[model samples]
Target: MSRRAAGVILLAISAFLTGVKYITASIYSTSSPNSGYGADSFKQWLDYVEGNLTTYSMIVLIAGIIYLILAEIDDFDKK
Candidate 1:
């Protein structure tokens, strides 16, 4: 696949993951006791979700930057 296509797909995946994280957090917050205060399970869940989100977001950002650079190079080559 092209850089642009890969970038778009990465962005879409990142967005979807973010949305899912938000929903999960919301649900946990509402159902848990005072937003998982003093709870080991809640802390673990939060940590897991946060780690995944951060990893995916970083991947998306890096892919997007690479895509932009590739596009710029293509443009320069044409000029």
Candidate 2:
């Protein structure tokens, strides 16, 4: 496939994963509807989840870069 098409597919996959994460989190939230305490707890959980997502995304990005670099080196060696 073309590089542009591969990029678009990866982007779409990432978006789909993000949407699923958000929807699942929403469905699992058991916080009270009228309690500020519950809201505070839920907010903390949301913050933690967001932080984790950011960290995982960064790791994945770095891994992809590494793979691309290695692939390029391997291709150059083949010429």
The TM-score between candidate 2 and the true structure equals 0.46
Model 2: lDDT of residue 22: 60
Q: Which lDDT tens digits does candidate 1 get at residues 1-79? A: 7766776777777788777776676567568664454567655666656867777877887787788678778878989
Q: What is the TM-score of each candidate against the true structure?
A: 0.61, 0.46
Give me the displacement of residue 75 in model 2, in angstroms: 18
Query: Local error of candidate 1 at 11, Å?
Result: 1.9
Q: In model 1, where do residues sit more than 4 Å from their true spots?
A: 33-48
Report clash pairs, candidate 1.
none
Candidate 2 error regions (>4 Å) = 30-41, 45-79
**Worst 10 contiguous positions by lDDT, candidate 2:** 2-11
Model 1, global lDDT: 0.71
Q: Top model by TM-score, which number?
A: 1
